[model samples]
Target: MKEDYLDIKTPEYVAIQFQIAGLGSRAAAFIIDQALLMLVNILSIVVLYFVMVGMEPLPVFLSHSSFPVAIVIIGLFIINWGYFFFFEFFSGGRTLGKKIVGIRVIQENGHSITLLASFIRNLIRLIDSLPTAYFLGIIMIFFHPKHKRLGDLVAGTIVVHERKAKKKKLTPIEKEINLRGLSQNNLLLDEWTLKSFTSKDWKLVSTYANRFTQLPLKERNQLTKQIADILLPKTGLDSAGKTERELEDMILIIYLILKDEWEFEL
Candidate 1:
């Protein structure tokens, strides 16, 4: 069964869901990558220190070899750069840890990004990580509405939650409620008829409801009756059959018209 009453309209709702998924996956991957890189750097430094100390016993060897140090630095740069390229280019925006955690990065409009887009985004991280004391990436995350980093912006991508499976069940009586007749076009809702609503659309309806209530009681009742008349034919219900409670029920029915299940009842 589907919970058709739930609606997500604002960007904040989307952003929050994205963040929850990212923290569990993308963020974990990043932390592991950084830890591994730091370990490699430390190990390189230790090996260089021992090599230099051993060379002190031989002046000729010490005087001739800054090349090894330069080579090690170059190797480190190549290793780090290649690591980023390998993951971003071939793995569909996931590193080993991200894959384990179940999240994939995709374009803002929801498409697979190209290798060049990924490269440009990560390469520019050098500038974003600047000032020798602070990370500009964190600042960018805080300032951007979508919490995107420079890489995300350049790649035109956003991290999103992988869709999870939903459990559904139905009752025997609910199976007999035919819902083929329900569709958005068939439901007629007007300002006054939705006055007592308390769902997501309630805010929208409440504005008009308040306005209608400001009029004289007789005028308000006449307006409500007029709205009911307009809705009756569209809903395929008789005038005598419909009641005030059906007004709110109609809103619920209209909202769920597109859902897979036909179990909704008043």
Candidate 2:
């Protein structure tokens, strides 16, 4: 079966692919979020009532004044908005629902979404829910090529699944890397240098190092040079005038360094 993929040539000039999440998964995720929100709202009102007017009958507390009602209204606004914002920005683009559904948001260009982008997308969610229960948003997602809603289009983001799970068995290239005794100790990379690399960098390096050995000579050289062009400069190492083997070795050294910091998850 043919699967739809969201392929982005990142600003870093590396090609990456993610599976595009479709309407069914996205709708389920939203339903989960709304259910959680409702539960929270009810709990909050109950807790506030108990604390503010203990043991008082619910009818009496409500009849006393508008203060409790007003507070509840304000609380609703904060909880609804803050829930999505905090999670999306800090949790790498997954709300609890999205996490459960195994999908996350990212920029159109294949980067982790920025804080501003997160804010914009969620803010526009109000419009996406327009006229009813996401009537407009569902239409946009169904018809659009990328399944993007107005929020996603405006914020330049899309939801996608994580990459295929990494294999447990060591491939031939991995075995060769182990045999060659290539590691961070062989080459120098400082703590600060390592900190500069993001998870995306690790993905690029790992993909290149693992696959280069499997290709034909010409293809291997081309792939090596393309990857080298992107990653080596970050390590204060230049690939210019270096042979393909040397480049491959440098990348392995980087992989060893990055391995200490990153677990291959997505």
Candidate 3:
């Protein structure tokens, strides 16, 4: 099949693209999920059987009056449906199967799947799995342009491969800091003194340091001085008699140090 893409725009009109997942990948993911569900269901049935009947013979289990078979049916129903609903609802639209397959369910508008949407989709999965397997669902997916089964079409969701995260290019401040070597030794920040700066302080510095490049020249200087004034005292440094450029360098320096402590590379 030709590679199909979904193009969407955010509220800000930033366009994004996603590749639609096709039958092969979706089927693989479903098989994985079904395998896991089968395991859980078997375990649950065994536990319930023992709990209801004890170690007693089949007569206890077979005794219609003593056996609550409806409970077993209900438990199995919940597990079969709940597995998909709970995982899709809470796991950002990816079950373990979908996550491993690198695909996720999302709304047609490209947002995360909503709770109601997840419920409706998985509820319709009963119909999708008609005639022993997902025969109808498979046919629908193979024929649908977006590869949506009835569940997805009904729920206004699509399965799409996750977009690989683009590496963030260095901000202007980062480039300048790299050029000037904004390291701990050069900045002379005492280890103990730096640790005193809290997450809130990091937010103050990071906001300005990372976003300074995007502001207009005059506004950038004003915000830099404002952020510098708030942060300097925490680091046992003052912005006294410093140029806005120098103040910006100091903020970027703090940013570099604190980011190391707080942020992990992804």
Candidate 4:
């Protein structure tokens, strides 16, 4: 049987998988945190009740006063919110839930999410949790291809698994040399370059291949040049030729590079 492997070349596709992993982790963390918080709150309330009872015989009217109960509720809310905010916003986007689940929230562009974004996302959780049981958020997850909740979509953020370290058979020197070569090419595409492809580009390439073929040679060449320029900053393409086909081949090479599966035919 052939060995199966996860492909990492398609950033969009990989992002989806990361979303799933992250959601699972976050859910688990939430349950644990809630459980712990509940236990602590219960214990504290019990202790407080005993202390209050020991101080004096409670009047019936005072016993029904909502002030103490309100304080406890507010305190619990603050503790839970504070813990979530600190970890999700400050600790590299991972809370105890995220850390155990091996996922973190990040910006849509694959950058670290800002404090503002984090705050907005968390604040919006109230809406996402509406109508009891977070049903809206759950529905969004099922319906959205990226499994984004209202907060994630509104804040232009995503949850992703941190890339795991893979053991490579290649020696350090060889790896360095390969990296250098990849960095030297002016026409080669890189991971970021390929991932930057717009939906229009994908549509044209996939659904309108015939129309693309009908474009003028100069136009096609120009398009290739633009793509090459975007990728050139990060890749080292052999500058021996400048043909359109050569440009396409270079893009393919970059796809392979991003996948870390390049094999030279020659």
Worst 10-residue lDDT window for candidate 2 reads 55-64
Across 100-219, the per-residue lDDT of candidate 4 in tens digits comes to: 767788777666788888888888888888888778877876566666789999988877667787687974434533554533253455566666654444443332233444568788
- Which stretch of 10 consecutive residues in model 4 shows the poorest summed lDDT? 1-10
**lDDT for each residue of candidate 3 in 1-98, tens digit (9 for 90 to 100):** 58999999999999999999999999999999989999998998888767756746555546675356777788889988998899998999999999
User: How high is the lDDT of residue 247 in model 3?
Assistant: 87
Q: To one decimal, what is the Cα RMSD in angstroms of model 2 from the true structure?
A: 11.8
The candidate with the higher TM-score, 3 or 4, is 3
lDDT of each: 0.56, 0.86, 0.87, 0.63
RMSD of each: 15.0, 11.8, 10.2, 15.2
Q: lDDT, candidate 2, residue 134?
A: 91
- Model 3, stretches more than 4 Å misplaced? 55-67, 169-266
Model 1 CA deviation exceeding 4 Å by range:
1-28, 42-64, 100-102, 132-134, 167-266
lDDT (Cα, 0-100) at 118 in candidate 1: 73
- Backbone N/Cα/C clashes per model: 0, 0, 0, 4
For candidate 1, lDDT tens digit of each residue in 167-229?
666432123122334344556556454443334333333332445425675675555555555
Cα lDDT of model 3 overall?
Answer: 0.87
Write candidate 2's Cα lDDT for 69-111 as tens digits.
7878999988998899899889999999999999999998888
Q: Which parts of model 4 are misplaced by more than 4 Å?
A: 1-25, 54-64, 170-266
